[model samples]
Target: GAGVSQSPSNKVTEKGKDVELRCDPISGHTALYWYRQSLGQGLEFLIYFQGNSAPDKSGLPSDRFSAERTGGSVSTLTIQRTQQEDSAVYLCASSPQPGTGNYEQYFGPGTRLTVT
Candidate 1:
Protein backbone atom coordinates (compact mmCIF):
# COMPACT_ATOMS: atom_id res chain seq x y z
CA GLY A 1 0.00 0.00 0.00
CA ALA A 2 2.04 2.89 -1.26
CA GLY A 3 1.08 6.50 -0.66
CA VAL A 4 1.14 9.36 -3.10
CA SER A 5 4.63 10.28 -4.35
CA GLN A 6 6.11 13.17 -6.28
CA SER A 7 9.32 13.37 -8.29
CA PRO A 8 12.37 15.64 -8.36
CA SER A 9 11.59 16.57 -4.75
CA ASN A 10 13.34 19.84 -5.58
CA LYS A 11 13.41 21.48 -8.98
CA VAL A 12 15.46 24.55 -9.87
CA THR A 13 14.70 25.96 -13.26
CA GLU A 14 15.25 29.19 -15.11
CA LYS A 15 12.42 31.54 -15.79
CA GLY A 16 10.74 30.94 -19.14
CA LYS A 17 11.80 27.31 -19.10
CA ASP A 18 9.31 24.51 -19.03
CA VAL A 19 9.20 21.92 -16.26
CA GLU A 20 7.38 18.65 -15.83
CA LEU A 21 6.45 17.47 -12.35
CA ARG A 22 5.37 13.85 -11.89
CA CYS A 23 3.12 12.15 -9.38
CA ASP A 24 2.17 8.56 -8.62
CA PRO A 25 -1.02 8.04 -6.71
CA ILE A 26 -1.95 5.06 -4.60
CA SER A 27 -3.00 2.09 -6.65
CA GLY A 28 -6.77 1.66 -7.23
CA HIS A 29 -7.53 5.11 -5.85
CA THR A 30 -10.34 6.63 -7.84
CA ALA A 31 -9.48 10.27 -7.15
CA LEU A 32 -6.29 12.28 -7.52
CA TYR A 33 -5.55 15.96 -6.93
CA TRP A 34 -2.80 18.48 -7.60
CA TYR A 35 -2.18 21.51 -5.45
CA ARG A 36 0.35 24.31 -5.15
CA GLN A 37 1.51 26.11 -2.03
CA SER A 38 3.29 29.38 -2.46
CA LEU A 39 5.37 31.07 0.18
CA GLY A 40 3.24 31.96 3.18
CA GLN A 41 0.10 30.92 1.38
CA GLY A 42 -2.45 28.17 1.79
CA LEU A 43 -2.67 25.21 -0.55
CA GLU A 44 -4.11 26.16 -3.92
CA PHE A 45 -6.10 23.55 -5.82
CA LEU A 46 -4.72 23.04 -9.32
CA ILE A 47 -6.51 20.09 -10.78
CA TYR A 48 -8.45 16.93 -10.03
CA PHE A 49 -8.87 13.60 -11.78
CA GLN A 50 -11.32 10.82 -11.11
CA GLY A 51 -11.50 7.49 -12.86
CA ASN A 52 -12.31 7.81 -16.62
CA SER A 53 -14.08 11.13 -16.45
CA ALA A 54 -12.66 14.37 -17.80
CA PRO A 55 -10.36 16.08 -15.34
CA ASP A 56 -11.33 19.28 -13.54
CA LYS A 57 -8.97 22.00 -14.70
CA SER A 58 -10.85 24.93 -13.22
CA GLY A 59 -8.30 25.43 -10.49
CA LEU A 60 -5.39 25.75 -12.86
CA PRO A 61 -3.91 29.24 -12.73
CA SER A 62 -3.52 29.81 -16.44
CA ASP A 63 -3.06 28.29 -19.86
CA ARG A 64 0.60 27.75 -19.03
CA PHE A 65 -0.31 25.05 -16.56
CA SER A 66 -1.68 21.69 -17.67
CA ALA A 67 -1.80 18.10 -16.49
CA GLU A 68 -2.75 14.60 -17.58
CA ARG A 69 -3.39 11.29 -15.87
CA THR A 70 -2.45 8.13 -17.69
CA GLY A 71 -4.45 4.93 -17.25
CA GLY A 72 -5.78 6.35 -13.97
CA SER A 73 -2.41 5.99 -12.30
CA VAL A 74 0.48 8.35 -12.84
CA SER A 75 -0.06 12.03 -13.56
CA THR A 76 2.20 14.75 -14.90
CA LEU A 77 1.88 18.48 -14.40
CA THR A 78 3.58 20.63 -16.95
CA ILE A 79 4.32 24.30 -16.44
CA GLN A 80 5.19 25.96 -19.68
CA ARG A 81 7.21 29.18 -19.74
CA THR A 82 7.71 29.04 -16.05
CA GLN A 83 7.52 32.28 -14.14
CA GLN A 84 8.85 33.46 -10.82
CA GLU A 85 5.30 33.52 -9.50
CA ASP A 86 5.00 29.87 -10.40
CA SER A 87 7.68 28.95 -7.88
CA ALA A 88 6.09 26.96 -5.10
CA VAL A 89 5.70 23.54 -3.55
CA TYR A 90 3.65 21.34 -5.81
CA LEU A 91 1.73 18.71 -3.86
CA CYS A 92 -0.08 15.59 -4.99
CA ALA A 93 -2.80 13.75 -3.17
CA SER A 94 -5.07 10.77 -3.71
CA SER A 95 -8.19 9.38 -2.13
CA PRO A 96 -10.16 6.17 -2.30
CA GLN A 97 -13.32 7.91 -3.41
CA PRO A 98 -14.34 10.78 -5.67
CA GLY A 99 -15.33 14.37 -4.87
CA THR A 100 -13.69 16.81 -2.42
CA GLY A 101 -16.27 16.32 0.27
CA ASN A 102 -15.69 13.97 3.19
CA TYR A 103 -13.05 11.67 1.70
CA GLU A 104 -9.62 11.79 3.26
CA GLN A 105 -6.73 12.42 0.90
CA TYR A 106 -3.22 11.16 1.45
CA PHE A 107 -0.55 13.69 0.44
CA GLY A 108 2.92 13.33 -0.97
CA PRO A 109 6.08 15.07 0.21
CA GLY A 110 5.64 17.59 -2.57
CA THR A 111 7.93 18.84 -5.31
CA ARG A 112 9.49 22.20 -4.60
CA LEU A 113 9.95 24.29 -7.72
CA THR A 114 12.25 27.29 -7.77
CA VAL A 115 12.32 29.70 -10.65
CA THR A 116 15.57 31.56 -10.85
Candidate 2:
Protein backbone atom coordinates (compact mmCIF):
# COMPACT_ATOMS: atom_id res chain seq x y z
CA GLY A 1 0.00 0.00 0.00
CA ALA A 2 0.98 3.63 -0.39
CA GLY A 3 1.61 4.68 3.14
CA VAL A 4 -1.05 3.62 5.67
CA SER A 5 -4.73 3.51 4.72
CA GLN A 6 -7.69 3.44 7.11
CA SER A 7 -11.21 2.67 5.99
CA PRO A 8 -14.48 4.47 6.81
CA SER A 9 -12.71 7.70 7.53
CA ASN A 10 -15.65 8.83 9.65
CA LYS A 11 -17.97 6.75 11.77
CA VAL A 12 -20.94 7.42 14.02
CA THR A 13 -22.65 4.84 16.20
CA GLU A 14 -24.75 4.35 19.28
CA LYS A 15 -23.04 4.12 22.66
CA GLY A 16 -23.43 0.39 23.00
CA LYS A 17 -22.56 -0.51 19.47
CA ASP A 18 -19.32 -2.06 18.29
CA VAL A 19 -16.99 -1.04 15.50
CA GLU A 20 -14.12 -2.51 13.59
CA LEU A 21 -11.51 -0.18 12.11
CA ARG A 22 -9.14 -1.40 9.45
CA CYS A 23 -5.58 -0.46 8.62
CA ASP A 24 -3.28 -1.42 5.77
CA PRO A 25 0.29 -0.52 6.42
CA ILE A 26 3.01 0.31 3.93
CA SER A 27 4.32 -2.71 2.15
CA GLY A 28 7.51 -4.27 3.56
CA HIS A 29 7.22 -2.33 6.79
CA THR A 30 7.82 -4.58 9.78
CA ALA A 31 6.31 -2.54 12.56
CA LEU A 32 2.72 -1.33 12.96
CA TYR A 33 1.12 0.84 15.60
CA TRP A 34 -2.33 2.08 16.55
CA TYR A 35 -3.18 5.26 18.36
CA ARG A 36 -6.13 7.31 19.53
CA GLN A 37 -6.31 11.09 19.34
CA SER A 38 -8.82 13.15 21.21
CA LEU A 39 -9.86 16.50 19.86
CA GLY A 40 -7.02 18.99 20.21
CA GLN A 41 -4.89 16.37 21.93
CA GLY A 42 -1.81 14.41 21.00
CA LEU A 43 -1.88 10.83 19.85
CA GLU A 44 -1.93 8.12 22.54
CA PHE A 45 -0.33 4.80 21.75
CA LEU A 46 -2.80 1.91 21.80
CA ILE A 47 -0.96 -1.04 20.41
CA TYR A 48 2.14 -2.06 18.45
CA PHE A 49 2.98 -5.05 16.30
CA GLN A 50 6.37 -6.27 15.17
CA GLY A 51 6.41 -8.89 12.45
CA ASN A 52 4.20 -11.90 13.45
CA SER A 53 5.05 -11.95 17.11
CA ALA A 54 2.66 -10.99 19.91
CA PRO A 55 1.52 -7.38 19.81
CA ASP A 56 2.13 -4.83 22.53
CA LYS A 57 -1.29 -3.78 23.68
CA SER A 58 -0.46 -2.26 27.01
CA GLY A 59 -1.78 1.12 25.96
CA LEU A 60 -5.29 -0.02 25.30
CA PRO A 61 -7.57 1.99 27.56
CA SER A 62 -9.75 -0.92 28.55
CA ASP A 63 -10.59 -4.51 27.78
CA ARG A 64 -13.09 -3.25 25.23
CA PHE A 65 -10.26 -2.12 22.98
CA SER A 66 -8.33 -4.79 21.13
CA ALA A 67 -6.27 -5.19 17.98
CA GLU A 68 -4.60 -7.86 15.92
CA ARG A 69 -2.22 -7.89 12.97
CA THR A 70 -2.74 -10.54 10.33
CA GLY A 71 0.06 -11.79 8.06
CA GLY A 72 2.23 -8.79 9.01
CA SER A 73 0.41 -6.50 6.59
CA VAL A 74 -3.13 -5.58 7.61
CA SER A 75 -4.49 -4.94 11.07
CA THR A 76 -7.89 -4.49 12.68
CA LEU A 77 -8.85 -2.50 15.75
CA THR A 78 -12.03 -3.57 17.47
CA ILE A 79 -13.84 -1.47 20.02
CA GLN A 80 -16.57 -3.39 21.78
CA ARG A 81 -19.47 -1.97 23.74
CA THR A 82 -18.41 1.41 22.58
CA GLN A 83 -18.91 4.28 24.94
CA GLN A 84 -19.30 7.96 24.33
CA GLU A 85 -15.89 8.57 25.84
CA ASP A 86 -14.43 6.39 23.12
CA SER A 87 -15.07 9.02 20.49
CA ALA A 88 -11.81 10.05 18.93
CA VAL A 89 -9.62 9.77 15.86
CA TYR A 90 -8.10 6.34 15.44
CA LEU A 91 -4.72 6.49 13.75
CA CYS A 92 -2.52 3.83 12.24
CA ALA A 93 1.18 4.07 11.63
CA SER A 94 4.03 1.92 10.37
CA SER A 95 7.80 1.92 10.40
CA PRO A 96 10.51 -0.17 8.78
CA GLN A 97 11.62 -1.44 12.17
CA PRO A 98 11.03 -1.13 15.88
CA GLY A 99 13.41 0.55 18.37
CA THR A 100 16.11 1.27 15.81
CA GLY A 101 17.74 4.63 16.26
CA ASN A 102 16.12 7.36 14.16
CA TYR A 103 13.26 5.19 12.93
CA GLU A 104 10.33 7.26 11.71
CA GLN A 105 6.72 6.16 11.59
CA TYR A 106 4.42 7.14 8.76
CA PHE A 107 0.86 7.80 9.95
CA GLY A 108 -2.44 7.21 8.26
CA PRO A 109 -5.01 9.95 7.71
CA GLY A 110 -6.97 8.58 10.69
CA THR A 111 -10.53 7.37 11.31
CA ARG A 112 -12.77 9.73 13.20
CA LEU A 113 -15.19 7.77 15.34
CA THR A 114 -18.13 9.14 17.27
CA VAL A 115 -20.34 7.37 19.74
CA THR A 116 -23.76 8.90 20.09
What is residue 89's positional error in candidate 2, in angstroms? 0.4
Residue 58's lDDT within candidate 1 is: 97
- lDDT (Cα atoms) of all candidates against the true structure: 0.95, 0.94
How would you encode candidate 1's per-residue C-alpha lDDT over 1-113 as one tens digit per residue? 77888998999999999999999998888899999999999999999999999999999999999999999899999999999999999999999865547589899999999
Model 1, residue 56: C-alpha shift (Å):
0.8
Off by over 4 Å in 2: 99-102
Candidate 2 per-residue lDDT, tens place, 1-116, comes to 37789988999999999999999999989999999999989999999999988889899999999998888899999999999999999999999966667489999999999999
**Which one wins on TM-score?**
1
Error in Å for residue 45 of model 1: 0.4
